[model samples]
Target: MLSKIRKNLRAFSFPLWIVAASFIGTIFLVWGKGSVSGPSGNEVATVNGEGITLTEFNREYQNTVTSLKKKLGDNFRKFVKEDDIKKITLNRLITRKLLLQLAEEEGLKVSDWAVAKYIEEIPAFQENGKFSLELYKKFLESRRMTPQTFEDMVREDLLIQKVLTAVNRAPSVSQFEIKELYRKVFGKRNFKYKLFLSKDFKPQVSQKEIEEFYKNNREIFKKGERESYYVLKFPKTKEGEERARKAYKLAKEGKFKELMEMKPQPLKDKELIEKVKEKGFSFRSQENGLELAFKLKEEQYKSLNEVRGEIERALREQKALEMAKKEAETFKGELNEETGKVDVSELVKKLKLLPTTNPEELLNAKVGKKLILPVEGGFAVLVPTTEPEVNEFEEDKLKRLKEFVLNVKRDSDYQNLLNLLRQKATIKVNQSLFRSVQ
Candidate 1:
């Protein structure tokens, strides 16, 4: 009899459908707290005088976490914390209560048979590609819920869906809106341009000027406190260690580079430093010249000579951008619309050329006007050579746009309804409850 009862219980287990509505429906279920109590024992919150027990809150919280974990994988922790999850879970519970209360007020009903039919249609509760009563019962049994309890949940879920469906009906998209949207997304323009890069117009800087700039921006040359080391590696064998000792002697004689010639390998400084930290190597060991020459941690600012090349490059880029802007302004009016295309190629040879076949940035720009477009190193002088070409009307694209517009409208209305419900509902949460959960 016990085995038969277990089988029956296992057959009625709840699946994904039980929690699907909760996550999607409760996305924007944010609410403010109020002070109220109802002989509080395990109640985490209350919505419209209806108690949301800690048990229900925890169950829903776990379900939501599990779903998010599946969707976000390892990044789940990055986006959500325990406290945030708890708050959201409570909000969802409050929203669920509000919606259920609304359903009750409006006399929304879902028959037991209807709930049963919904369960039967679920693929997870099926066996051998067909719905099985035994499988359904077993599923419910595993969750420690009776068939009646699971059916009740399904009934509530169905009612919520009914309420949402009534509000979420798709709106019709006008032809004008679709056409406008199509134009915005699919518009393309051809640009003829000559780019002037910083490297091409690099201004010559004297040593005195570089020193003056460095003096003015001394803080930019400040280096972090660091420990410099002279690193050397040898094989683990006795002969290798003996050779390393010899090499250490050579290093003392300032032949560090010649010593490094014994083994030619690319030593990535950062990785080597990390490995040293992990292994807890001491300076006293002097193993394989690893601790042969080490400097005390000290703050050292970079000299003008060390960063002279970098500063020059920055100054040149600044000058180049300034010069390019002037050149583009001067060149803009010289070429007329008819001759612009022919002049572009000759101008490109003189400056850095950036010819975009269909430039999205200039989609709405006039064909004859020259634009000073910023590039990575400098700027470009561009003219839209061709008007944006709109493709022939596509039925599939129009249909998709209509559906997209409908969904957007539905979402907005649904959110507004939720906000209105919150105004009408009285919600109180126990702030202390979240501390224990974490």
Candidate 2:
């Protein structure tokens, strides 16, 4: 159950909040706070007068934290802050409330039998892959939740799912639409292109320019202090600890060759470099009784002379690219489409014209149209030589394309529906309570 919650939380995205809500289901059922006395007190937020209680918000926040902690381990704080997590949790709750209210307004109903079946199908309440009444009772009892409350939560979940499914139904696809999409995906065109290669253009670089570049971009030339260290890691056993101690003693005495015989690898952890700044021996312990030892090396950097050749090459490439773009633009300006006097075929032969496979630009380009398009290594002046032709249709490929188009339409429709609902609904949030969330 924890693993399932973690997986859903990790995969949660704001646009697909409805899908995440479906996975969350009645997990919050156990966290139910008994009847709200007033809208302003315990309720964290209200969706069209429906209160999302503080207890519910807290539980959701804790569940989100648990899921993230399990997934990210010790590095969880590095990725997300507490304030961000709180905002995500509250927004999710508000969205869920909005959808559920929308479901009620749309008259979406969930039957008692449907709710019962959903609860029965839950693996947590099952024994030996079959629904067990005894396990179900015990599970609810352990969570301090009654069967009535749990079943009601399940019914609400079912209604939300049903309404989302109804709203996101795939729209009808016309034959013309499919054919156009088919052409777009599988069409091919013959195009002639003259690529301006930067390597072919040699731009003169002066010694003064190289020196100025080196001075201006000193940070790029500057290398960080790097220290290499050998790590001797051993398992959690008694024998492992003894071996680690022996390895550490040898490492301190500069017996690296003897340490190499013990199979210690080079330590590459950046954190260790910060901890052990000086050249000496360092020891650490890891999970499950694992022991480790490190022997550090003095940090060093290279002189400017060592990287002068690299800097010169970079400057030359920069100037060459600029030259290539200008030359391509100049050639593009020379061609006259109306007069047809440019003899493109003769120029193609003389300049070694390359074939363009950029389908998007090619599809949009009409015959006799010339485009100055950017290409790898430089720019290219492209002209479509032939009209686009749809390739032979394969059933599998067309089916995939149809599905892709349908999904895009559905996603757009779903977002539009959510926007309309949000615009109509009166959502009131308790800012004080939300700020109090830790």
User: Pick by TM-score: which candidate is best?
Assistant: 2
Candidate 2 lDDT over 1-438, as tens digits, reads 223322433443222112553433221111123232325788887777788898788877877788779879967979888777776676667667767776676555677777777787888888888999999888888867789978877777776666556554535577678877776556655556667889989988888888887777777755665545666778878899899888878867876557767876777787775554565556778886554545544435455678778878988999998999899888844442321222333333444444553445545667878777666678777776665556477789778888888888766666565566666766677777777877
Q: Best-fitting candidate, measured by lDDT?
A: 2
lDDT of candidate 1 over 388-411, digit per residue (tens): 556676889888887888889777
Question: Measured by TM-score, how close is model 2 to the native structure?
Answer: 0.66
lDDT of each: 0.64, 0.67
Task: Return the clash pairs for model 2, or none.
Answer: none
Listing every candidate in turn, what is its Cα RMSD in Å to the true structure after a full C-alpha superposition?
A: 13.3, 14.2
The C-alpha stretches of model 2 lying farther than 4 A from their native spots are: 1-39, 66-76, 134-146, 226-301, 333-359
